[model samples]
Target: MQPRKDNAGFSIIELMISLAVLVIIAGMATANWQGTIERHQARQTKQELRTLFQVARHTAINRRQMTTFCPLDAANACTNDWDQPISVFIDPGSLKVLAQPDYLIRTFKAMPNGTLIASHSGPQERRYFQFNPDGTVHGTIGNLTWCPDSLMAERGVHVIVNFGGRIRWGKDRSGDGVVEKASGQPISCA
Candidate 1:
Protein backbone atom coordinates (compact mmCIF):
# COMPACT_ATOMS: atom_id res chain seq x y z
CA MET A 1 0.00 0.00 0.00
CA GLN A 2 1.30 3.35 -0.90
CA PRO A 3 1.95 5.61 2.04
CA ARG A 4 -1.13 7.68 2.67
CA LYS A 5 -0.52 11.44 2.36
CA ASP A 6 -2.17 13.65 5.02
CA ASN A 7 -3.19 16.79 3.21
CA ALA A 8 -3.35 19.16 6.14
CA GLY A 9 -4.00 22.86 6.17
CA PHE A 10 -5.97 25.09 8.56
CA SER A 11 -9.12 23.32 9.59
CA ILE A 12 -12.40 25.24 9.49
CA ILE A 13 -12.42 25.62 13.26
CA GLU A 14 -8.79 26.77 13.31
CA LEU A 15 -9.43 29.23 10.52
CA MET A 16 -12.40 30.68 12.42
CA ILE A 17 -10.29 31.19 15.54
CA SER A 18 -7.54 32.84 13.53
CA LEU A 19 -10.05 35.12 11.86
CA ALA A 20 -11.45 36.11 15.25
CA VAL A 21 -8.01 36.92 16.54
CA LEU A 22 -7.27 39.02 13.50
CA VAL A 23 -10.52 40.92 13.90
CA ILE A 24 -9.72 41.71 17.48
CA ILE A 25 -6.26 42.88 16.54
CA ALA A 26 -7.65 45.06 13.79
CA GLY A 27 -10.17 46.57 16.16
CA MET A 28 -7.49 47.48 18.66
CA ALA A 29 -5.29 48.92 15.96
CA THR A 30 -8.10 51.09 14.69
CA ALA A 31 -8.83 52.43 18.17
CA ASN A 32 -5.18 53.24 18.70
CA TRP A 33 -4.99 55.03 15.39
CA GLN A 34 -8.01 57.15 16.23
CA GLY A 35 -6.57 58.10 19.57
CA THR A 36 -3.31 59.14 17.98
CA ILE A 37 -5.12 61.34 15.52
CA GLU A 38 -7.16 63.03 18.23
CA ARG A 39 -4.14 63.74 20.35
CA HIS A 40 -2.29 65.06 17.30
CA GLN A 41 -5.15 67.40 16.52
CA ALA A 42 -5.11 68.77 20.03
CA ARG A 43 -1.38 69.34 19.96
CA GLN A 44 -1.64 70.96 16.57
CA THR A 45 -4.11 73.47 17.94
CA LYS A 46 -1.83 74.44 20.80
CA GLN A 47 1.16 74.69 18.48
CA GLU A 48 -0.81 76.92 16.15
CA LEU A 49 -1.76 79.21 18.99
CA ARG A 50 1.85 79.37 20.09
CA THR A 51 2.96 80.15 16.56
CA LEU A 52 0.42 82.91 16.15
CA PHE A 53 1.34 84.39 19.49
CA GLN A 54 5.01 84.47 18.63
CA VAL A 55 4.43 85.77 15.11
CA ALA A 56 2.20 88.56 16.33
CA ARG A 57 4.70 89.56 18.97
CA HIS A 58 7.60 89.56 16.54
CA THR A 59 5.66 91.42 13.86
CA ALA A 60 4.74 94.13 16.30
CA ILE A 61 8.32 94.49 17.46
CA ASN A 62 9.88 94.35 14.00
CA ARG A 63 7.33 96.40 12.09
CA ARG A 64 6.98 98.96 14.87
CA GLN A 65 3.23 98.57 14.63
CA MET A 66 0.53 97.66 17.10
CA THR A 67 -0.49 94.06 16.50
CA THR A 68 -3.83 92.97 17.87
CA PHE A 69 -5.01 89.44 18.79
CA CYS A 70 -8.69 88.82 19.29
CA PRO A 71 -11.43 86.29 18.94
CA LEU A 72 -13.45 86.37 15.74
CA ASP A 73 -16.69 87.49 17.37
CA ALA A 74 -17.14 91.15 18.12
CA ALA A 75 -18.42 90.14 21.55
CA ASN A 76 -15.09 88.48 22.22
CA ALA A 77 -16.77 85.27 23.20
CA CYS A 78 -16.09 81.72 22.01
CA THR A 79 -19.32 79.81 22.61
CA ASN A 80 -19.02 77.41 19.75
CA ASP A 81 -16.90 74.27 19.62
CA TRP A 82 -13.49 74.09 21.20
CA ASP A 83 -11.90 74.99 17.90
CA GLN A 84 -12.75 78.65 17.45
CA PRO A 85 -11.72 81.17 14.83
CA ILE A 86 -9.60 84.17 15.68
CA SER A 87 -8.23 87.24 13.98
CA VAL A 88 -4.89 88.97 14.11
CA PHE A 89 -4.26 92.34 12.59
CA ILE A 90 -2.01 95.34 12.68
CA ASP A 91 -3.54 98.68 13.46
CA PRO A 92 -3.64 101.22 10.68
CA GLY A 93 -1.51 104.27 11.28
CA SER A 94 -4.72 106.25 11.40
CA LEU A 95 -5.91 104.10 14.35
CA LYS A 96 -9.04 103.27 12.39
CA VAL A 97 -10.36 99.78 11.62
CA LEU A 98 -7.94 97.52 9.80
CA ALA A 99 -8.28 98.70 6.21
CA GLN A 100 -10.16 95.73 4.81
CA PRO A 101 -7.40 93.10 4.99
CA ASP A 102 -4.58 95.55 4.41
CA TYR A 103 -3.59 95.31 8.05
CA LEU A 104 -4.65 91.68 8.43
CA ILE A 105 -1.61 89.76 9.51
CA ARG A 106 -3.07 86.31 10.03
CA THR A 107 -6.51 84.78 10.12
CA PHE A 108 -6.90 81.37 11.77
CA LYS A 109 -9.78 78.93 11.92
CA ALA A 110 -9.95 76.50 14.79
CA MET A 111 -9.56 72.80 14.14
CA PRO A 112 -12.69 70.71 14.46
CA ASN A 113 -11.23 68.52 17.21
CA GLY A 114 -10.23 71.44 19.42
CA THR A 115 -11.90 74.69 20.38
CA LEU A 116 -10.24 77.98 21.30
CA ILE A 117 -12.37 79.97 23.69
CA ALA A 118 -11.66 83.31 25.33
CA SER A 119 -12.61 84.61 28.75
CA HIS A 120 -11.36 88.00 29.85
CA SER A 121 -10.67 88.90 33.41
CA GLY A 122 -12.14 92.32 32.99
CA PRO A 123 -14.63 93.78 30.53
CA GLN A 124 -16.41 91.36 28.19
CA GLU A 125 -16.78 93.54 25.12
CA ARG A 126 -13.10 94.20 24.61
CA ARG A 127 -11.45 91.41 22.63
CA TYR A 128 -8.28 92.79 21.13
CA PHE A 129 -5.00 92.35 22.96
CA GLN A 130 -2.80 94.93 21.33
CA PHE A 131 0.93 94.44 21.46
CA ASN A 132 3.13 97.51 21.10
CA PRO A 133 6.31 97.74 19.08
CA ASP A 134 8.32 96.98 22.21
CA GLY A 135 6.63 93.57 22.56
CA THR A 136 4.63 94.80 25.52
CA VAL A 137 1.04 93.64 25.43
CA HIS A 138 -1.74 95.95 26.56
CA GLY A 139 -4.01 93.78 28.64
CA THR A 140 -4.48 92.61 32.16
CA ILE A 141 -4.34 88.91 33.07
CA GLY A 142 -6.81 87.51 30.59
CA ASN A 143 -7.45 83.76 30.51
CA LEU A 144 -8.26 81.50 27.59
CA THR A 145 -9.16 77.93 28.46
CA TRP A 146 -9.11 74.97 26.08
CA CYS A 147 -10.42 71.58 27.06
CA PRO A 148 -12.02 68.51 25.67
CA ASP A 149 -15.78 68.18 25.99
CA SER A 150 -15.41 65.29 28.38
CA LEU A 151 -14.89 66.00 32.06
CA MET A 152 -13.17 62.71 32.74
CA ALA A 153 -9.94 64.10 31.39
CA GLU A 154 -7.55 64.81 34.23
CA ARG A 155 -5.71 67.69 32.56
CA GLY A 156 -6.76 70.57 30.33
CA VAL A 157 -4.80 73.38 28.67
CA HIS A 158 -4.98 77.10 29.35
CA VAL A 159 -3.38 80.05 27.63
CA ILE A 160 -2.79 83.00 29.89
CA VAL A 161 -1.61 85.94 27.83
CA ASN A 162 -1.15 88.57 30.45
CA PHE A 163 -2.12 92.09 29.50
CA GLY A 164 1.56 92.38 28.74
CA GLY A 165 1.01 89.87 25.89
CA ARG A 166 3.27 87.34 27.58
CA ILE A 167 1.79 83.97 26.61
CA ARG A 168 2.01 80.82 28.68
CA TRP A 169 0.15 77.53 28.74
CA GLY A 170 -0.70 75.29 31.65
CA LYS A 171 -3.42 73.45 33.45
CA ASP A 172 -6.76 75.04 34.27
CA ARG A 173 -7.61 73.79 37.71
CA SER A 174 -11.16 75.02 38.10
CA GLY A 175 -11.69 76.26 34.57
CA ASP A 176 -11.69 79.66 36.27
CA GLY A 177 -9.14 82.07 37.68
CA VAL A 178 -9.48 81.00 41.27
CA VAL A 179 -6.44 78.71 41.11
CA GLU A 180 -4.72 78.24 37.76
CA LYS A 181 -1.22 76.82 37.29
CA ALA A 182 1.38 76.34 34.61
CA SER A 183 2.53 73.01 33.22
CA GLY A 184 6.19 74.08 32.87
CA GLN A 185 6.10 74.34 29.10
CA PRO A 186 8.83 76.48 27.58
CA ILE A 187 7.24 79.64 26.28
CA SER A 188 10.02 81.94 25.17
CA CYS A 189 10.14 85.15 23.17
CA ALA A 190 13.30 84.17 21.34
Candidate 2:
Protein backbone atom coordinates (compact mmCIF):
# COMPACT_ATOMS: atom_id res chain seq x y z
CA MET A 1 0.00 0.00 0.00
CA GLN A 2 1.32 3.46 -0.95
CA PRO A 3 1.70 5.93 1.90
CA ARG A 4 -1.14 8.52 1.98
CA LYS A 5 0.10 12.18 1.58
CA ASP A 6 -2.73 14.46 2.70
CA ASN A 7 -2.98 17.71 0.68
CA ALA A 8 -4.73 19.90 3.20
CA GLY A 9 -4.24 23.46 4.59
CA PHE A 10 -1.96 26.16 3.11
CA SER A 11 1.57 25.56 1.90
CA ILE A 12 4.52 27.66 3.11
CA ILE A 13 4.64 29.62 -0.15
CA GLU A 14 0.92 30.40 0.02
CA LEU A 15 1.14 31.58 3.64
CA MET A 16 4.09 33.83 2.83
CA ILE A 17 2.27 35.41 -0.11
CA SER A 18 -0.80 36.17 2.02
CA LEU A 19 1.29 37.71 4.76
CA ALA A 20 3.01 40.04 2.26
CA VAL A 21 -0.32 41.16 0.85
CA LEU A 22 -1.66 41.97 4.33
CA VAL A 23 1.32 44.15 5.16
CA ILE A 24 0.90 46.09 1.96
CA ILE A 25 -2.76 46.67 2.65
CA ALA A 26 -2.07 47.85 6.17
CA GLY A 27 0.56 50.32 5.02
CA MET A 28 -1.77 51.85 2.47
CA ALA A 29 -4.57 52.21 4.98
CA THR A 30 -2.33 53.92 7.49
CA ALA A 31 -1.09 56.43 4.92
CA ASN A 32 -4.61 57.41 3.94
CA TRP A 33 -5.73 57.68 7.56
CA GLN A 34 -3.05 60.24 8.39
CA GLY A 35 -4.17 62.62 5.67
CA THR A 36 -7.79 62.35 6.69
CA ILE A 37 -6.93 63.09 10.31
CA GLU A 38 -4.88 66.13 9.32
CA ARG A 39 -7.70 67.61 7.28
CA HIS A 40 -10.27 67.09 10.01
CA GLN A 41 -8.08 68.65 12.69
CA ALA A 42 -7.35 71.71 10.55
CA ARG A 43 -11.03 72.34 9.84
CA GLN A 44 -12.04 71.81 13.45
CA THR A 45 -9.56 74.40 14.66
CA LYS A 46 -10.80 76.89 12.07
CA GLN A 47 -14.41 76.48 13.17
CA GLU A 48 -13.50 77.02 16.79
CA LEU A 49 -11.90 80.37 15.96
CA ARG A 50 -14.87 81.44 13.88
CA THR A 51 -17.21 80.64 16.75
CA LEU A 52 -15.05 82.61 19.18
CA PHE A 53 -15.19 85.65 16.92
CA GLN A 54 -18.94 85.33 16.65
CA VAL A 55 -19.17 85.23 20.41
CA ALA A 56 -17.11 88.37 20.67
CA ARG A 57 -19.21 90.19 18.11
CA HIS A 58 -22.51 89.11 19.59
CA THR A 59 -21.43 89.91 23.12
CA ALA A 60 -20.56 93.42 22.10
CA ILE A 61 -23.93 93.91 20.42
CA ASN A 62 -26.05 92.16 23.05
CA ARG A 63 -24.49 93.97 25.96
CA ARG A 64 -24.45 97.20 23.96
CA GLN A 65 -20.86 97.54 25.07
CA MET A 66 -17.37 96.89 23.78
CA THR A 67 -15.91 93.39 23.86
CA THR A 68 -12.29 92.33 23.57
CA PHE A 69 -10.57 89.07 22.65
CA CYS A 70 -6.91 88.50 23.44
CA PRO A 71 -4.40 86.07 24.88
CA LEU A 72 -4.36 86.06 28.68
CA ASP A 73 -1.18 86.56 30.65
CA ALA A 74 -0.49 85.64 34.27
CA ALA A 75 -1.82 89.04 35.31
CA ASN A 76 -4.85 88.50 33.00
CA ALA A 77 -3.63 91.17 30.62
CA CYS A 78 -3.48 90.78 26.88
CA THR A 79 -0.38 89.21 25.36
CA ASN A 80 1.06 88.89 21.86
CA ASP A 81 1.28 85.12 21.99
CA TRP A 82 -1.72 83.21 20.69
CA ASP A 83 -0.73 79.86 22.21
CA GLN A 84 -1.81 80.98 25.65
CA PRO A 85 -5.35 80.90 26.96
CA ILE A 86 -7.58 83.31 25.06
CA SER A 87 -9.84 85.68 26.97
CA VAL A 88 -13.11 87.21 25.89
CA PHE A 89 -14.35 89.90 28.19
CA ILE A 90 -16.17 93.19 28.49
CA ASP A 91 -13.93 96.15 27.74
CA PRO A 92 -14.31 97.18 31.41
CA GLY A 93 -14.76 100.84 30.46
CA SER A 94 -11.07 101.17 29.73
CA LEU A 95 -8.87 100.75 26.61
CA LYS A 96 -6.00 99.24 28.56
CA VAL A 97 -5.29 95.50 28.89
CA LEU A 98 -7.95 93.35 30.46
CA ALA A 99 -7.95 93.05 34.26
CA GLN A 100 -8.23 89.86 36.31
CA PRO A 101 -11.21 87.55 36.94
CA ASP A 102 -13.64 90.45 37.30
CA TYR A 103 -14.10 91.27 33.59
CA LEU A 104 -13.43 87.86 32.04
CA ILE A 105 -16.41 86.43 30.18
CA ARG A 106 -14.82 83.27 28.82
CA THR A 107 -11.43 81.61 28.47
CA PHE A 108 -10.38 79.30 25.65
CA LYS A 109 -7.77 76.65 26.31
CA ALA A 110 -4.47 76.50 24.47
CA MET A 111 -4.24 74.97 21.01
CA PRO A 112 -3.06 71.45 20.21
CA ASN A 113 0.58 70.62 19.80
CA GLY A 114 2.22 71.51 16.46
CA THR A 115 -0.64 73.90 15.71
CA LEU A 116 0.13 77.59 15.39
CA ILE A 117 -2.02 80.74 15.40
CA ALA A 118 -0.83 83.77 13.50
CA SER A 119 -2.51 87.13 12.98
CA HIS A 120 -2.23 89.51 10.08
CA SER A 121 -1.51 92.35 12.41
CA GLY A 122 1.76 92.88 14.27
CA PRO A 123 2.33 92.33 17.99
CA GLN A 124 0.36 95.37 19.06
CA GLU A 125 -2.68 94.55 16.96
CA ARG A 126 -2.66 90.80 17.59
CA ARG A 127 -2.79 91.44 21.30
CA TYR A 128 -6.44 92.43 21.12
CA PHE A 129 -9.60 91.87 19.11
CA GLN A 130 -11.90 94.78 19.80
CA PHE A 131 -15.55 94.44 18.85
CA ASN A 132 -17.45 97.67 18.64
CA PRO A 133 -21.05 98.29 19.71
CA ASP A 134 -22.20 97.84 16.11
CA GLY A 135 -20.64 94.34 15.95
CA THR A 136 -17.77 95.50 13.81
CA VAL A 137 -14.12 95.05 14.64
CA HIS A 138 -12.36 98.19 15.78
CA GLY A 139 -9.32 99.54 13.93
CA THR A 140 -7.64 97.49 11.18
CA ILE A 141 -9.28 94.47 9.57
CA GLY A 142 -7.14 91.37 9.65
CA ASN A 143 -7.26 87.60 9.46
CA LEU A 144 -5.90 84.74 11.56
CA THR A 145 -4.05 81.86 9.96
CA TRP A 146 -4.63 78.51 11.67
CA CYS A 147 -1.56 76.66 10.50
CA PRO A 148 -1.23 72.97 11.27
CA ASP A 149 1.89 70.96 11.97
CA SER A 150 3.01 70.26 8.43
CA LEU A 151 2.64 72.47 5.35
CA MET A 152 3.60 69.62 3.01
CA ALA A 153 -0.13 68.99 2.44
CA GLU A 154 -3.37 71.01 2.54
CA ARG A 155 -3.64 70.72 6.29
CA GLY A 156 -4.11 74.32 7.32
CA VAL A 157 -7.03 76.82 7.44
CA HIS A 158 -7.64 80.54 7.69
CA VAL A 159 -10.17 82.55 9.65
CA ILE A 160 -10.74 85.73 7.70
CA VAL A 161 -12.50 88.56 9.50
CA ASN A 162 -13.50 91.28 7.08
CA PHE A 163 -13.35 94.93 8.03
CA GLY A 164 -17.01 94.77 9.02
CA GLY A 165 -16.29 92.10 11.62
CA ARG A 166 -17.78 89.47 9.33
CA ILE A 167 -15.82 86.28 10.02
CA ARG A 168 -15.63 83.58 7.38
CA TRP A 169 -13.55 80.45 6.91
CA GLY A 170 -11.32 79.81 3.90
CA LYS A 171 -12.10 76.30 2.76
CA ASP A 172 -11.63 73.99 -0.25
CA ARG A 173 -9.71 76.38 -2.39
CA SER A 174 -10.43 75.95 -6.14
CA GLY A 175 -13.00 73.31 -5.20
CA ASP A 176 -10.41 70.64 -4.57
CA GLY A 177 -12.54 69.55 -1.59
CA VAL A 178 -9.54 69.92 0.73
CA VAL A 179 -9.56 72.50 3.53
CA GLU A 180 -6.52 74.78 3.42
CA LYS A 181 -5.32 78.33 3.71
CA ALA A 182 -6.46 80.25 0.64
CA SER A 183 -3.54 82.59 0.39
CA GLY A 184 -3.23 81.41 -3.26
CA GLN A 185 -0.98 78.62 -1.91
CA PRO A 186 -0.17 76.48 1.10
CA ILE A 187 1.37 78.51 3.86
CA SER A 188 5.00 77.96 4.79
CA CYS A 189 5.76 75.62 7.66
CA ALA A 190 7.57 76.72 10.81
- lDDT per model vs. reference: 0.61, 0.73
Q: What TM-score, to 2 decimals, does candidate 1 have? A: 0.62
Model 1 segments beyond 4 Å from truth? 1-12, 71-84, 92-99, 120-128, 145-157, 171-190
Pick out the ten consecutive residues of candidate 1 with the lowest summed lDDT: 181-190
184 Cα displacement, candidate 1 (Å)? 12
Give the per-residue lDDT of model 2 (tens digit) for 1-190: 9999999899999999999999999999997987787778876777678778988899888888788988877766777788777788989564636755576778887665445566656545377788888998887776666656665435666676777889877666566544455365545445
What number of clashing residue pairs does each candidate have, in the order they appear? 7, 0
Q: List the residue pairs that clash in candidate 2.
A: none
> Where in model 2 is the C-alpha error above 4 Å?
7-16, 93-96, 123-125, 150-153, 172-186
Candidate 2, run of 10 with poorest lDDT: 177-186
TM-score of each: 0.62, 0.78
Question: What does candidate 1's lDDT look like per residue over 4-40, in tens digits?
Answer: 9896898999999999999999999997776666566
lDDT of 2 at 153: 38
